[model samples]
Target: MAFEIVRQECMKNPEGRSRPCNPEEICEVLENNQGSDAIQGISLDLSQVGDLQLSADVFRKMPNLMFLKFYSVGVKRSCSVKLPSGLESFSNSLSHLKILWNGVKNFGNLREINLAESKQLTALPDFSAAQNLKHVDLCGNIKSLKSENQLKSLAKLIVVGCYGLKEFSFSSDKITYLDLRPTSVEILDFSTGCMEKLQYLVLNCSRLKYLPINDICCMRRLQSLVLYDIGGLIDKSKLHSLFDALLSLKVIHLDGAFKLTDLPNNTKHLSRLRCLCVSNCKSLQSLSELPPSIEKLGAYECSSLRTLQLTSHFEPSSLADKKLLGPTLCYSVSYLRNLQRLTLKGCEQLYELPEFMDSLSSLSSLDLSESNVESLPASIKHLSNLKQNFLAGLKKTSFSARIAAIPRNC
Candidate 1:
């Protein structure tokens, strides 16, 4: 039942092997072989089938099936597709399920469900029978999802684009990752600090003005944090203190924050930090200090930044001007030897490059696209190990000569 016979000779020989078939062929096989206990999983792409007459009875007979997935691009607007029903009673073996851009409305009896970009999916059926369910991702406009007791085991839930979802509740301490990036939830009350186990939280709500800072601090294990494309709802003061509270944090991404002028004061203390991405902040003037352990740094489109400072961990003798050095180094990025990739795209007001731009011997990549820098220092030719240097669409093509002069010696 898993493979379809391609020719008449194949069907004539009962012991012959079969080959993989298209979605239409698989549907025919499912129709003829009603009770297939050996087929543990089935993945179908029904985008080309104009009118599919799929039925639930065909799947109900497969007692041992564990995985089910259906992918359709614009199926609701392009064609008619009938999905299986009574999936809530799917055999206990069912675990993983995914439906992408399809017209499926209800599904159950699975431990995980990843339904993304399906605009026609309005609801998720009851989960009372899906006791094994643990993770669900309905990231696009799901309107009808109800509460149930089976959520106790749920570990990860991402409902980012569900605009009609006002609020949803769960055991705050049990869930680890919760992403409400584009949901219509106006407010979230985390003052009780019940989400101690929460690690990754993404919020981009339009009406959310204040977040539970104390609750976020209570999440001792929280690591990766992303606050994307929201208005100035969160106080920059609270965000500044998060690095001190979340010692396990490694990545921090904040994009399109219109009110943030400065970041956390003690960024160098983040021992395990690896990546820092801050972009699209219209009012962010400059960064006073950066962590010493960072490997990837992106400061794209911060139009107001005029100066950047790196951690003062290098000896003064390594720099050309020892008298100009301050408690924290400014324009001394040459000492950030651990940095492998750096991007400063779209900062339109900057007119000069750092004097020690080429001292970063370990640096492998640099991007300065769409920036207003008027000249590149002659010392940029000192970057011996640089692999990728991007300078697309800059003013006057000043970096062209310095880029062409780099020695080809490996």
Candidate 2:
């Protein structure tokens, strides 16, 4: 009978449109069919409703209810729906919930909850009884979240754009993926025995001045680590410590870190690292020997960079030495054997390429646009796999005809 009432209300609207339900109308339907065992689903659009006050046992009588979604669309004002305190339990069969309420006590069967963009939500309900909960996505002005020793089964968590969030910590050892991008979180506490199974972490907080390096080093299975715009938070020594611990990492992306002057001098320990990208780091001056496992290397708009050492054999003590003519090339040995794509665009101070450029036999695409490179090494003609070469703004170079004459039949 409850489903019949909801169906009749929907039939009054246009084919593909829904009429927003007010507080009184919604209360009437639920009250009239309070004990009905037929209500299995409910989706209400409360865009036109104002402040709604409901009893605590409103959903207690619906034993078979499995899904409940109460959302507002195109409403500019705060959508307030007050659920009374001591709301003991949702339906025992309920599995999915997407609402803006804070009174539910026992979510024994619930699997996922999405409260994204709930601007008025400042606190989370106790989830001690929610043993089956697995995924949670939270966003808005939430200030503090401490999921200590809870959510034993949680596997994924995302908390993006929470500008007012200041403190956060989760002790879910089963979690495999976590993202906290673009937040104002200042205190992130990751104590022992937390996030041990995590495989991916993306942190883009600008105000985060310190990272718990000891706790992060515990994530031995982490594969991808992306740190964006976290200015001056990680110095060279701390980064070196991180590299030593996170040896299983495959991809490392560092961008907009204005205080970084150099990467770790010896990355050969990261044997599995495949891609290394450092861009827009204006203060970075040099790149030392990288792991031979790197397939793609990109350093763009690093305005202060003056040297690139591709192998351990080529070492220069200082950038001021005029004798350091070009990229230190190894004539007898081939390094970076698996390298496929190399981009050094917008590095205006970089003046030369390795004279033994042919050693990079797997090189396919090369971009040196808007740089100060004087000439392309003649050895480049021997690269049989070279396909795309971009030298757009090299006005000071004398290799235009030489570059065009290279064979393209890769």
Q: Please, what are the lDDT tens digits per residue for candidate 1 over residues 1-410?
A: 43543433255432121322456655665555444555555666767666555544555556445456656786565554454442323332232332222443334445565554443455565555555566776754454444534355567878757787655544433778988768776556665336678888887766665666776787888888887776675446877778779888788888888888877677767767788888898788777666656788888899987776643545555555466444345433455667888788888766666666655666777777788777766766677777534545455565566566353443
Which pairs, if any, clash in model 1?
none
**TM-scores for all predictions:** 0.66, 0.71
The alpha-carbon lDDT assigned to residue 382 of candidate 1 equals: 71
Error of 2 at 175 (Å): 1.2
In Å, residue 282's CA in model 2 sits off its true spot by 1.9
lDDT of 2: 0.70
Candidate 1 stretches greater than 4 Å from native: 1-109, 121-131, 139-150, 191-193, 311-334, 397-410
